[model samples]
Target: EKWAATRAKYPPTTLALQHFDAAYGIQLGHLWPSVRAALLCERKYGALVNNFSDDDVLSDLQDQGCRDFISDTDLEVHLEQISAVGVEGESSDLSTKTSDISHQQLSPLQISRNIKCLVFPRGDITRFKPAKPDKFGLLGYYLMDAASVLPCLALDVQEGHNVLDLCAAPGGKTLTLLQTQCLGFLCVNDSSISRTLRLKRVLHSYTPKPFLSGDNLRITSFDGTKWGEIERDTFDRVLVDVPCTTDRHSLVEDDNNIFSRSRTGERRRLPQLQLELLLAGIEATHPGGEILYSTCTLSQTQNQSVVEQAIHLAQENHSIHLQVVDLKPLTHMFRKTFHFAPNLHLGEMVIPHLAANFGPIYMCKLKRLT
Candidate 1:
């Protein structure tokens, strides 16, 4: 009864929404409404992990009536619109919204810039009429957010590089890395069994059986905070895509989300864990190797501050130095199709907005110097 009363007073979106406002108000003020509206809407724009399908997924989707978002002329013009631009030029009033955002015409940008993944124009996704029953049909594009590929792109995995995907759950980013055909051996790990099961299921459907059982890939259930100790100086590239207070899921999904009274305490501890996990990833990287730290939240505590503190602690505590790899060049190259927060020194973030509605994804890349 107390729980019921608490929920009645606060409502589902209350705590999460208030948390974001307090956490991100300085950075997202005035643009928060549209971001809220986009998150509330059900028909979210998502990407097809194209490389999963053997054939050209983009051309196949196009042939099936799905249009490429980046190539859409309307979206291109809307991107630069004076009023409609912000949140990476991604604002709109919730009061002025339709029942669903996808009801309005919006195109999905090739979130990966075709090199990584493709985004579906909002409404056209329902019109996807696949011609054949194969991997493409079995693998629907909407399984992942359009911007999920950002970290993999930033990681820049090279051929025969040893890689670690710490906290790899559901495995969408893992699939993206495979697209590069990089990795002498990929060590995929997630702490949670349920999430790891989902990751296994992803590999089962999208990946070949021979490959899953082969020497190239090994999935482990390990505490990500201890990964560095477990496998020190082991990887050529490491992707520490740590588990976070997933902003979109937190706001829209009240049940099983982090905002509840019982879970909020653990949520409060995320930054510290994030820092430790990042430091562990740093420890796991070979000297002269690269590591990409990422999160799906817009919180500075989770994103920038975590990266900042980890860089200092990794050096001070272990005598290991790391150099920041500038992500501005990547954001600029991807700007035409996606909306990114301007002037983030540590990394690039995809700002959630009405036009692209892709991400609240933030990533920073660092290279081990010592």
Candidate 2:
């Protein structure tokens, strides 16, 4: 009855809560309220410094409650190939070392230990909403959850790699990929024209005018699931951050939400679509290439089940093989900055907490072998 009353009070969040209750509320237990209550407060967000340009200084963001680096601690890797881990009993090395990420930069505030994103605690969002320029002119940082940037980092983009961001829209992870400055060619695409336009605009904000349209970068409105046919075995790295329920935003905002009355069918079909996208991403990956599959929601069906099915289908139909890259080492290294969900077979989920309110972002890494 109280939940009914609260739902009546906030119609925007009702459908999401109901769906969550049906989906995984039993697992959430008391943490469900933590997610609910955290929604009422300002969100803790992070800033990714623009590696492309230095025209704008943003030191004032640190004063505005930006506390520390996402992970300043040295990562001690204790990860073995995740056994059975829900994907079947096969195991493979996740393949990363503490020495790989131990490099430090001169910046004391945010050591450039590979991932240069900054963490801001709650009650510290005044700088992001209106985007406070502060005393250092325009802020040089791109405001986002520190968690959303993980997939791009884990994708391990390198110089001269031909990269494809298949479902890239509103383009946040795309920007993080750009920060690497390692791409020989980048194709950013989405099925939605509006989203593709928004992605183009996001690129425009951070990218130089000349570089946005040349031989290096290309933007298109393509059916993300059909990408394998369009560019077969082409990219060195691929990022398929598929469109999911967007659980956190779905609860807070009602406009065009998947939980809404108009989109119930769309929501139901998401797992199938996610599975197709992952398969297509794998198909587009060159032999010995890597791909990072991600979503911004917590639906188990949309995440692990989809990856499991894709793994099954990829080998069964096309004779392609994918090695699931274990991410336990990465999650543990940044434990202080993120609250990761336990026992997940395919990926890492940053569970939202009232104290550390961020995410519900799930990412799984894979490598395609011919």
Candidate 3:
């Protein structure tokens, strides 16, 4: 009612409508009609489109005498309020101790450190689709969270390293590992048969022929919990991108959406399953090797608590030695664009941004001591 009343104060223009349509095209899932009507009633509707694409469209609007177009600079400044952009380390929450990586080994992956490249993954990812689809996906790069890509960097993959991506379906992180460093062999596994097929397709679509034909890649559908008993101490580096409550998929404006039905069930089963996967990754990693545990949720029960419980269980039950790899230094480097959530003793979090619209990822890097 308040928004509607405020919107009534202004009038909509044709250029504004066009720009709103473009934004709706980009975020097709979030087309709330009420919001659209409100945006139309007010002049505030069209500027959201400016954030997703370059200024060429705006230039065209200007040429058409659409003087009402929002400038990119203005959008960026507004976006900062609801975004993680420009946050400094000193201002971070003191409750969560930052992961300390100073004594840890440096990242083996060569990073571009370019803000442009880092921010590209956060944009309307469909823009990354290629004109021609090839095995290499030369133009169709897998779009994923930039923070999710950080786990591979945390692993510090070296040439000839043996790696495992447990629960590796839809192959985004798997692709990152392959792209970042040379590996002797990579074992990709997911428990679901259908998801495994999707992972295989992703691998086949992106990996080159030499890698596919070579004995270096193994794709499997196995119960991930049994991996610790099955492939204990096998991999030089391991990644556990465990399944969790993906909040993005759960968000719906309609009260009657079926998506909420399994929310309780998922929350109930997720933490233990997450711990099982993390422990399995730990068991599979060679002594002195590292494992990167990550999830796409903001739930503390699933993120920090799972890592803490797994660490305790591994020590008490299996008598295995594990160490949380400090990520403080790395987080410091990324503070400007991606400040982590506070009070995390086990990992780093990238909170979801309403404007930027990417991620709610949590990642913890761990090493097997013995």
Candidate 4:
């Protein structure tokens, strides 16, 4: 009733609340009042607090009964208080250590070349110039960053682990795991046989290691969802980078009428299909393994909501415990937007404005607790 009243009072603010409820199945009435109050206060007192320093205004506001007049300094003080209370900052020095370890793992040649490429423009490189465009056929493509491939690679892929890339084709992330040189076998499956063959050609370019060679890497054509029924808990890691509405790529929209309807339908249908795919991926994932769920869309229905639903379903079935790895630090640095789920233990979201190139990719890394 309170929620209904609040929604009636402020229609626009309630829209996000309604969307959140529909998407994640959580009722957050207590938080709504505070959120609404904050919005109202922000509108009423924002200008006064906007430029005020801690000493100049927040102290005054507190004494004057405007407790929520949060200035930049007030935010800093709050964080300091929280830090004093032992709440962890999103990125600690541990991230630096991990980054250093990642650097150390790279060969000197790789590091030097990476640094040189960053310092010198690509076309100016002396060893090999950027390839000229092939007029005859498409030869190469570009992705925003290699970091986008990291989640799929870091998924519970260990030495001698059997992995499945359900819907894998044009293999950017599939190749990331192959490069790890750790997996026992990689089953790269796609619905399209032609695309799977293309994936094979791409994987074939890399020198086959003992773990990732001819027999270790198998390309098959199959509907991904059926894998659950055919082979349950068979893979140590599963990558379900599902198809989604490519609205972020609106610049490439060829036909407005067709594209808009398709995009809308994709947006509506994605959450349910994504939830199914994730559940199937989890079914394929061995106990104590992980699955990386990703999409190149910004929709909450496709990203966090689907993950939450999967987690709930998994809990009901006692199949696996979902642990969400925090991608907040990564998203913050990259300026990505994430629509957070109330109950998520871990996840990452990359919004459109953040990426320099193609984007608004949402990714979540989930581990199945044994």
lDDT of each: 0.71, 0.73, 0.60, 0.50
Q: Per-candidate TM vs. native? A: 0.81, 0.83, 0.67, 0.57
Which portions of model 1 miss their true places by more than 4 Å?
Answer: 1-7, 49-56, 64-116, 121-142
Segments in model 3 whose C-alpha atoms lie over 4 Å from true places: 1-100, 103-105, 109-131, 134-140, 252-259
For model 1, residues 1-370, the per-residue Cα lDDT tens digits are 6555544687556788888878677777777677777666653444554455565566766665545443344544543342232223212221122222221112112222443445555433352333232553435343577687777777876657888999898898887776565458998999999999999987766656666775989998989999877989878889999878898888877788888888878988999999999999999999989899999988878998899899889878999987776554455546766778775656779887766677889998887879
Model 4: what TM-score?
A: 0.57
List the candidates ranked by lDDT, beginning with the highest: 2, 1, 3, 4
Give candidate 4's error at residue 235 in angstroms. Answer: 2.2
Ranking by TM-score: 2, 1, 3, 4
Choose 1 or 2, whichever is better by TM-score. Answer: 2
lDDT of 2 by residue, 1-370 (tens): 6555544454646878877877676766666676657655666777777655554334555666665454455423223312212234224343332232222111211322334677766434444643433332333667787789877767777668899999998888888787766578999999999989998877877766656766889999989899878888899989999999988788778778788777889988999999999999999999888889999888888888898888889999989987777665566556777788876756788887766777888998877878
Evaluate model 3: give its lDDT: 0.60
lDDT of 4 at 214: 66
Q: Best by TM-score, which number?
A: 2
Predicted structure 1: lDDT: 0.71
User: For each candidate, how many residue pairs have backbone atoms clashing (under 3 Å)?
Assistant: 6, 0, 3, 2
- For model 4, give the 10-residue run with minimal summed lDDT: 114-123
Better of 2 and 4 by lDDT: 2
Best by lDDT: 2
